[model samples]
Target chain A: MDTLNYLLQGFGVAFTPLNLALAFAGAFIGTIVGLLPGLGPINGVAILMPIAFAMGLPPESALILLAAVYMGCEYGGRISSILINVPGDAGAIMTAIDGYPMARKGLAGVALSISAWSSFVGGVVATIGLVLFAPLLANWALAFGPAEYFALMVFAIACLGGMVSDRPVKTLLAVLIGLSLACVGVDSNSGVYRFTFNDVHLADGVQFIVVVIGFFSISEILLMLEESSIGQSIIKTTGRKLFNRQEMKETNPSTLASSIGGFFIGVLPGAGATISSAIAYMVTKRVYDKDGSFGKGDIRGVSAPEAANNASATGSFVPMLCLGVPGSGTTTVMMGALALYNITPGPMLFQNQPEIVWGLIASLFVGNVVLLVLNIPLVGFFAKMLTVPNATLVPGIAAASAVGVYSVHATTFDLVLSVAFGVLGYLLRKLQFPMSSLILGFALGDMIEQNLRRALSLSNGEVGILWHSPVSLTLWIGAVAMLVGPPLLRRLRRGRAALAVG
Target chain B: MRAERVFGLVWLAVSAAMAWVALDLKAPISYEPVGPRAVPLLYAGLMAACALTLVLRPHAVAFHWPHGKVVHHIVVSAGLLLGYAFAFEWLGFPLATALLALLLGRVFGGSWRTCASGGVAMGIVLYLFFDRLLDVVLPLGLLQPLFGG
Candidate 1:
């Protein structure tokens, strides 16, 4: 009953005319940005965030708009994937496998509409899960002391190192680089500068927006320029835009199962939409692909990954809102935005700022519905956005990024820093370093250090306190398991395959 | 692969430098048991270890290096971006942005006509959007005399 009342109050906040309009605008802009090749949700949110701040939006409203954009991109990512066989973002990679084939088979409209519907279903279901599970998790987290928090953060980093990339060492290196970057300012506890190098601008630490925009958006522009041409032949949308009844019925089960699976996977720290979609597609293939048409324009293949990715996108919000730990790079950026507002998203958030938390949750419901209604009729138009010349798009994005960063701090120093990071980001991408882990490390570094210090202080400098509590011990064990489990499982699978071949 | 090894060596040197500096940090009357330097030192050590691993066991991976006309395009685009960053305040938002866009458009294969017109139009529209609608104070530079920013 209490939860119901809170949700009702949340609806009251979300339904305000201004909030509704902002949500619509965010979703609309997010869709267009997501439809653009190489501009994923991370870039979409990063570029708009400074604008949101400049507009002086209240923290809750700003979050609602950004979250709507996050959700909108999930729907929009399928546009290029289905039409041109190019994934608009990393999360849409699996969609292109079957979605492109369907387009080639002249079922482009069907593929797109079904994926949109599946995405809607996934988003709605995951939002329900978030509402039901986030409070419980937040309540549990209230029991955590600094030791437990330190352990938990360790587990989160370990998960990223173990799962985010094929090379754990490389991922760990990226995380360390991020931590080093995080250390480049006055120490909050001691007020002593660590790595300022006698620069006044470096005293406040590298701004998150600068790092995010530089690493993702600016470098993306450079990468786009490296390509000779952006032209791709988009397949014509010949078939019905809406899925027929039989087709819908055939994909309903896969969609539901993938949504559930993806949501759970997303709830796990460091597991993101790409992995969720991949796992969901594999599970659907093994269970339901009896005709062996899994890759050649199968409607189920199109729906499965779409549903899972969207669900996982929503699911990634759980740890971020409840535990103050972001599950993905995009969510980390969102959390960084929240930090700028001095609103720490954790157990106390529910008590201190219920409106921000609940309003964001309520708006997700509204955002998904708005996206579905907006996407079905407008997807073709969005697909046409692919024709927007890269020349105009690239320079426009560059200008927006530069101006956005400058607008916030009104400093030329930050502009130079952004370009520097852009160069670093380009190199990192070329070297196959997992940039997400680095960003996550940067986001979590201060918290981990604070918790470690507090826990040590409590224990009079005894390191054993980190492992003393049950929660801490469990988290430490989980970290070890995350590190050791993947390789063991892979070896076992490889051995089994070798035996079968022999 | 050789690039990875070189990057690892450079990273190791950076970590060593970080550790050296961390060793010099002094915290007077610390509130916590661990001082400010401990966390950074720990990160530096861990990073150094990771860098050593990469240096020792470098994997063979191919990098996508641009060639021919692509190299020229990338260089020109990068140069334009850097120039825009330095000249932003001096050239002002409108003029600098327009020039940057025009050059970038040409690098991306847009014809001169479209590049010039589109760049100017986009610069004016964005200026109005940011300056008027969003209430952001953009540096007008040379345009300040006429526009009264």
Candidate 2:
């Protein structure tokens, strides 16, 4: 009943005229940004965030706009995948596996409408899950001491290393670089300067926006410049209508199941939409492909990944709101946005700032509906974005990123710093290192170090204090498992395959 | 050699240098059990170890750098943007942003006429949107004498 009351109050906050307009605008702009080649949810928010912040809106309004953009991108990512066989973002890669094939089969209209519906279901279900599960998780996290937090952060990074790619060592090095970057300001506890190198800008450490925009937005511009020409022709959606009732009934159950599964995967600290959507698609394929029609334009294949990615995008927020640990790369950028307003999201956010927390949740509910209504009728319009010239867009993108970075501190030094990180990001991308883990590491660096230091101080400098509690001990075990489990499982799978062959 | 190997070598060198520099930071009045320097040193050491792994194992992946005009485009745009950043306050919004847009449009293959028009539009539009509507502080610089920013 109290949850209901709070949600109602949150609706009161979300339904305000200004918040409503921004949500609509955010969804519209976010979809355009997402469907553009090489741009994604992170860039959408990172580029727009400075403008939103400069508007001097309250923290709740700012979060509302950012979350709306995040959800809209998830919805829009499927368009490019379906039309051109090129994914708009990492999460939509699996969507293209079946989406483009469906488009080729003259069912492009059905695919777009049904996928939009699936995305809507996934987002709505995940928001409901957030309302229910986030508080319970926050309550559980309240028992965590410093040692447990430190252990949990390591487990988060290790899980990211384990799940992200085959190269854990590279991920570790990237994360360590981020951690080192995080150490470049004045020490919070001892008030001692560590890596400032006599620069006044170093006093506050590298700004979170500078690093985020530097990495995702600025580097993306450079990458887009090299890959400028879009050679693939888009499948036209001429005079095609929305999916009918029969198609919806056919996909209803699988979409719901994928939504639930994707939401849970997203709740895990390190796993994000890419993993969730891939797992959901594969699971649906294994179960439903008894007739061998899974990947060659199966509607379920398109719906499954779309639903999962959207649900996973929402589910990734639970950890950020509950524990201040970002659940995915996009949420990592959102965390930086929250930091811009001096608002650190965690348990206290729920208690002291219910308007911010519940208001954000409520606005997502509203935004999902906005995305659905806008996507179906506007699918043709958005597909046209595929043909938009890179020449005009790149300069505009660069200007937005420049103004975004420059507007914050109004300084050229930060602009140069962003360009430096952009170059670093470009190299990292070319080298095939995971950029998210580095940013994740940078995000969690201070917390882990401070927690370890605090726990040690409480224990009179005894290292034994790290695992003194059951929570910390379990986290340590989990960290080890995350690091070790993937390779061992891969080996077992290979063995099974060999045995089957024999 | 693979890009990762060469990059890893440089990273290891950087981390070692950072670790050396980290040793110099000391707190005369320390409250925490771990001194301020310990965290950076620990991170730097871990980074060094990881870099060492990359240098040793050296996995191979195919890489193709864009040739000729593409390389020129990338290098010139980078240099132009950096110049824009440094000259931002002095050259101001519309003029500086217009120049950046003009050069970027050209590098990306726009004709001179379109580039100039687009560049001017970008400069003026963004200035109006960010400065006038949002009230975010933006410098006018040379335009300051006329427009009075």
Candidate 3:
């Protein structure tokens, strides 16, 4: 009842004229940004953050805008994944398997409609989960100490290690690289410059946004050059009817199952929408075996991953709000944005800033509704965006990015830095290195360092203190399990397949 | 085989340089026994390890040099950026952007005519929005006279 009253207050704030207007505009723009190739929620949010800050909206309203971008992006990313064979982000990668096939089968309309519908349902379900569960989770996080936070950081890094490909060690190296780069500016505890190397810019530490833009966006531009074409090969898309009763019935079960699966996966540290969606697609395929049209344009295949991805996106917030730990790359960016706004997310957030928490949560429901109405009716318009000549779209994006970066700081130095990072981002991407880990590492580096220093300072530099608390110890165990378990599980599955063949 | 060793050796050298930089910090602000040098030094060690692995891995990882035309595209892109940087400080936002955009647009498959017209259009949009509407002080350079220096 108390929570409900607080939530009603949240609804009141969210529905205010200006906030509601921001929510609608944000969702609308966010969907378009998400639909654009190579940009996902993280980039979409990061790119638009300067504009929001420029507007000088209060922290809560700014958060509402940014959060809506995330929600809208989760909806928008599926379009490219389904119509083109390109996943905007890893989470959407699974959506591509069945989605592209569906598009080719001329059911692009059916696939897109199902994707939008399932995402809306998953998002709404997750919002309810947030309302009911986040407060309880926040209460649990209140018990954490500095030691626990240090453990959590380690767990976060380990979870990151688990998420990458064959090179777990490389991922570790990347994390170390990020942490080392993060250590560049003057140490907060110690005024000593660690790796500034006599540059004035080094004294202030590397900006997380600069590093992220360089590693992901710029790197992507370079890699795009290697590909034969800059845009999708235009196809005559088919399927005009949006949805019928039979189609809805076919998807509902998979939607429910995947939503549940995605929600749980999302709550886990580091694993995110991409993983959830992939797992859901696989599970649905394994269980249903519905004529095995999964990879060949089956509507259920599209529904499963889309539902899972959106649900996981919502679930990812569970840790960010409740535990002050971001569960994915986009959330890490959100956390960084919050840090810029001087708002720390944790257990006390609910008590200390109920309106920010609940209003933001309420806006999510409203954002999804706006996304559904805008996405379904206007999808054809967005799909036409794919037909934009590569020559025009690429340069336009580059110019917009350059303008956005410059607008943040009128400094030519920052543009130079953005360009430099963009080149480096291009190269790192070529090697199939996970840039998410790098961004995550860069974002979390300061937290790890600050917390470790604080905990050590409290314990008079005794390293054993990090393992003292039960919560900290358990979290460390979980992190280790996550890091080591995935590969082992894969190997076991492969072995089982061999045995079965024999 | 030797190429892998050379690549690893260069990384090792870079790691050594980074380690030296890490060692050269002034002093700690608050007393922690290890100071700020510990993490960087740790990175130095890991970088060295990775560098060693890269050099020692004998199984050939195929390295393909891109075609000359592709290389040209990359060089052109880099050159455009370099020009943008130099031009931005001297010519300011409008002219510098126009030149850079024209060059970049051409390199990325735009025609000279397209580049020129697109550059001007892009410049006006940026000028009005960034400088006029948003109160951004873009470099006026010679244009400063017209806009009140």
How do the predictions measure up, each by TM-score? Answer: 0.98, 0.98, 0.93
* Fraction of native contacts under 8 Å reproduced by each candidate: 0.80, 0.72, 0.34
Give lDDT tens digits, candidate 2, residues A1-502.
8788889999999999999998998899888888876888988888778888888988888888989999989988899999898888888888888889988999899889999999999999999999999888888888788888888888889898888977888888888988889998988888888778899987989887788888887777777767746466999885466888888888888899999999999999989999999999999998788888777988999999999999999999999999988999889888888888888888778888889889999999999999999999988889888886776788888878888888788888898999889888988887877889989988888888989999999998999999989988898899899989998999999999999999
Clashing pairs in model 1?
none
User: Could you tell me the lDDT of residue B89 within candidate 1?
Assistant: 85
- Tell me model 2's lDDT, rounded to 2 decimals: 0.87
Candidate 1 lDDT, A135-221, residue by residue in tens: 999999999899999999899989987898888888888988888898889998889988998899999898988888888887888
Tell the DockQ for candidate 3.
Answer: 0.44
Q: Could you give me the TM-score of model 2 versus the true structure?
A: 0.98
Instruction: Work out the iRMS of candidate 1.
Output: 1.4
Query: All candidates' lDDT scores?
Result: 0.89, 0.87, 0.77
> What stretches of model 3 exceed 4 Å from their correct place?
A236-239, A500-502, B1-11, B26-30, B50-65, B130-142
Worst 10 residues of 3 chain A by lDDT: A424-433
Tell me the docking grade of candidate 3.
Answer: acceptable
What TM-score does prediction 3 earn? 0.93
Model 1 alpha-carbon miss at residue B14, Å: 1.4
Candidate 3 positional error at A38, Å: 1.8
Q: Which stretches of candidate 2 lie over 4 Å from their true place?
A: A498-502
